[model samples]
Target: MALTPDEIDGLRELILAVYGPVTEELLRDLCRCITAAGQISSGDEYKLLLAKSLAGADDVIADTLRRQTDLTDDAVEQLMRWAAEKTAPLEENESLRNIAEAYVKVTRKEVANVLGQLAAADVDGRVYPIKDVYRRTMDYVFREVSSGTKTPEEAVRRATLRLWQRGIRTVDRSDGRTFSVEFMAQRAIMAKMGEMTTAINEKHHDDGGCDGWEISAHSASAPDHEPYQGRQYSDKEYKRLNSRLQRRIGTLSCKHIAWPIKLGVDSPQWTNEQLAEMARENAKGVTYEGRHYTQYEATQQQKALENSIRQCKDRIAAAQEEGKLGSGELRSSRILLRQLNAEYKRFSAAAGLRTAPERLRAAGLGRALRPDGTLEMPRPAGTLTGSGGKLDVEEARKSYSAYLDTLTDAPEKNMVWLRYFTEKNPTEYMEDGTLDAPFAYDPVEDRILYNPRHPQFSTTDFEMANTHELAHRTDVLNAQGYKNKAFVDAISDASKAVLDNAEGFQRVAQAVRSDLMKDILSALSSGRLDTGFGHKAEYWAKNSEAVPLEIFAELFTMETRNDSDLFFVKKLFPGLWKEYQKLF
Candidate 1:
């Protein structure tokens, strides 16, 4: 087979263009996978094995993973043991890498969040969680394919052509009593023994392992082994082709702290006080209304309002100051103060008071204090207001199950079990999306916010909205105890250090951005195209290698198409690539 180095570069560069630069570890892992493209047991080869192994029994995969990824030889042996037990996770990240494990956690959270959000996003609306099977299979393929052969286009052509050209066939070496190739190709490179063994589903008569599976050496093929497809894969041909492509996509996605967090300044020449004073000075030029307030009337109105409020408070004080005033006088002063307080409160809250009576009396009095500089104003408190009731378990389950029917291979998926595992999680706050996470926010409220809103292509809001929350979950709130402290601050500090170095540009967030974009692109490509995807495809391509990866976050962000889309499982991430645009 023929392939080229430039194609590998193009594919890698294109991956960056579409997905973004992968993380250091993932990049390293991909490098290892790609470099070992022609070599046996490369990344992609393992992935195929793992995929085939996991396609049937998930428990086996889980058990193997549980024993592996422990950073010890014993763990490796245990993993080997379990794989032999149920066939096994054949990929590097599958129960093999800690980051991969972490990734599963993050993605699982996304799945769970979609379910939770879907249940809560709508009250009386029909929703469908969109899914695409071909895209998923493509993901598995691309993730393990190696581009290190330096002949990607050629290799792709050859691999695609091989299926039709000479075709594949299996034979028996009656002497060795093993399954061998009936015909040999000009350059049939042997990549692995088991890859051929597994690919052909060749059961070794002498092989020993759990059930009817083969584990050890590929000594011979079983006599009862049936023919594969129209023919059998030559051990040499099978390994060569499988390993070639396997290594091609055996790319490991590395994750790192976002560039903004990494690029954080530790010791600037200007101190915090200096920064604050500068902010105050900057604030001086603008009036409260967010416009200019240089001349008389504008400033005068503010002054008058202050004076009026102060005068009201003074009246209240006076009633107490002089004992000559009756209870009626005190009542009148309190009412006057309240009216001034009401005016201020009205300005603060566009909505009328929803405050409890006890809070009203105290907060109302505090508002009166804002008039006089001497009187202390109470600090405004933020509330996590949300509207939703307990989920009708039956309805939610029915909707989710119905949505599952849209998928191609539902029975093989164990994710439904997870649905039974997690009931709906309550959303106590909205601030989590905007203010709660670390790094700079892209909110319209802040002038320094990186990007303004990019409208989604779909008329609905649920898909992206669902994905957006899940991204937040993965990015910031994945682990426990993050809510308890300023963890983002410390992480930001460290990430800032990483970003200061040139290597920081190749952080994990960048890779995730790339991975997601590629997945989205693949999802949109083979499956039904949404037709209305704007320049989002270009946006992802541009940010594929963006430095300071925080700038590329838009690549993975999603929003709901509508309230129903929020709660619907079918639409969770369903082929919505347009929403990723503008992060570049």
Candidate 2:
């Protein structure tokens, strides 16, 4: 709940009254003490001396508190709480000070009004009636003059003359109001307290991952003041605002405070069954690439796919404009677009959307009849390529043959077609193409893809990448006894022993045993690990489930780089490494 603007105005009015007298006394004490000291040259020196002076004003303090300003003790406490909540989010001392500075600036106008009243009282026998308003103080001043019981013109004239004497023309630039430092100090404290309260409330809700807040209006607040009072916004239709800009129970300055409401506590509307139903409807659990997504996660994944599809479309449009539509660039982009649209369709269907969940109309879907009744394949949109236009197939095949010659225990060269990607259509190429990994193996399809645009694609050591990808194929393809269930079971049994004996592998193995394996494998498969050799080594070694496939690839590359690495490779997988080396 937030304080309504009217309530805030009333509180400010009351606080101004209370603050004015105390402020005047404090200023008086500061001046007297500064004069006594006689040599305050610096700001720090002045503040130090001012602090000593304020400590001596016991009688003034008692008198200031004794004066009735219409604010109850409860109201004062509420203001303190408000101040705390506002400052609660600030963690650093410097950040808290910055917030305090902002509050001090806003409240300075009110401080100026109070100072004007005090100044007038000093000069004239009577004081000018004032409120802590920043703009149009004269309106309030004139209103006071007309409403007061006695000598309206006399009071106005005396106050006006006094103001003139001090050269205080406008409330904004009140050079005569010399007590700004003290005023700012008081406001800084109040602002920090309020900010702390905000931080506390936010931390609670955030930590719990709870939905919405329980808004309550002030007790004395009128019926028409805040209709939103006692309402909740936990539903999907209600979009939540950022915490600071979030609507409170009442308008600004209203003394309404909102508290975090745990789900199923005060919210009878949010039953466990309803939450489960929402999860089923919106976030229908999605499993992709061996990883499962919750309702929220599924929606987020769909958004990602949509974004990729859009970006791919933009790239396709740019390629057409550049007259590259006839090149492999267009075909590669179309291929990627096709893959993305397929995945997006699958996701949407799982989430229960109405659009047909089918493959995009592309080259593979049979031709539709022309208006003249001629049999024609419906060519891809915006394509200038002829029906038989081909990529540089011969060059890619040669590269694949050369790459295979370097592999020792690599699968048969012809087993997988090395489809050289001519255009790096960011969306499609490899499984984790964004990482720029040179090669990717699709085990289900038994195809090894070579990314021609990879940074290491043209390098002499490119065969190492081929070895890495080939490791995946070797495990899955029916080379000797490789593709059988028994082979996978044997690898699993062997991996258990290696994991038990390996240093730093047990903790990762333990993590893999828990529900964390999916997340770890996803990270590894996507190449999301931090860059650099050491980080890659640490990542691959730790992901125990992925280690079986990854270890061979990593060791193969390492052995190709230096023969010394073979000692460790043989030690790790004596039987497999020996067998794999025979293919070289």
Candidate 3:
């Protein structure tokens, strides 16, 4: 088959237009999946990239083959009708019919083979290596396709030709199984004609021989065979012609064509400059959503959103792992994450992208903080909260589960179970004169021991009991002794450093350094530091034995209640307050 330069050029144009956008969209989806999985290395990333490309190729080829069959069927039917309309009817109609039928079957098999190869690669997580020249050809093909100017037929032809060229190029260097482009084109022409011949012969079996039918061979590439040019044969004779002269016509680099009869063809033949101009026309950017984006620019935007969401999820995981969920910084981080999630949702919706369901994890745990900037319970549905006369074990369990969601630690998750206990005497205060605290956390057992007595429940309050004990447990299970004497000593050292450098405090606070020190010391010793009278000496040891844990528990409780206790604590231990925030 001798295809004019114009037809080849038109075929290239059609293939680019059809395959461009489809391939681009596929690549974007694949990139997002890989980024979300946190696979960034070159080899691993490229493996997925290749898998997606193969899948894209399967789609491109499948669509192309379907379209090619439609066009071939139409072209052959038109040619057959034109031949039958002639004053002197021609033969070879059977050959044309058989070729069209065979072409469809052969191309369908080829498409299926490509799809099967891609499926195997996907299952094995393997990537085929692309040669540099083939990669460049595909890149150019994508650009032209994205330009959106070529017809579907041209796009399909160009895609098929490029891939065909790659195979032929490699086979020549390896085993020489396929000789040249002309040989390949000629073989395709023969296959189509052969199928058409078979179909026509089956239909005209009652007719003896091909009386009015004629098959002719034409080729500009084989001018030396002028004797064979315009050679006509009957339908039955055409079937034998292949065997008679198969060696010369079906060999390496042979460019030949067999037309059923008279042929009148007119197609645009582009000049070198005109072809260059056509390529320029196909290089223009596509417009979407009021903005123009090159294929590369659109790909970059897709990658940025995918990577940003992945990073946000990673941070949340890290904070949970470190058990710093209660800190002010982590509270702020959660707020930032909420904002990122909203952004992700909007971006994906706008781009018509689908995000993973895992992105919705911890949706209810938004930025909920107490007034003093401590993180609060997420309070997801089904968590128990209010008070009643008798203890409802199930409700208590649900409420405790909700509270536990706010904390982070092994003990907080596992051993810190809740149970009710009662004292022999129902007194408002312990014998030690400390107020009878309703709930006490047992360090040894890692449990919250609750006073179930009616008098204690009424006086102690539900939220207070829940928040205070959880805070105590957070200190024991997660924060450990980070809030203890060592922490206080760091405060003392920082205080000494600041006070000794009086100019520093003067600059930051605009206060007299001596007066500030005097105020802090006075407040620390005023017995007000021992605020919130509590039951059992175990909860708050006297004097210096009062672990920083008690002070933190009290402050956290006060913060949750929105009381002024946080301010008092800050004033009494200004140095500790400054250092405490950093420690947690």
425 Cα displacement, candidate 1 (Å): 6.5
Backbone clash count for every predicted candidate, in the order shown: 54, 31, 22
For candidate 2, write residues 511-571 as lDDT tens digits: 3321122222223333333222322444545644454455444444444333333553356
In order, candidate lDDTs are 0.26, 0.40, 0.38
Candidate 2 residue-pair clash tally: 31
What would the TM-scores of all predictions be?
A: 0.17, 0.22, 0.25
Better of 1 and 2 by TM-score: 2
Comparing 2 and 3 on TM-score, the stronger one: 3
Task: Give the per-residue lDDT of model 3 (tens digit) for 227-248.
Answer: 4434454445655665667444
RMSD of every candidate to native, in Å, equals 34.9, 31.8, 29.7
lDDT of 1: 0.26
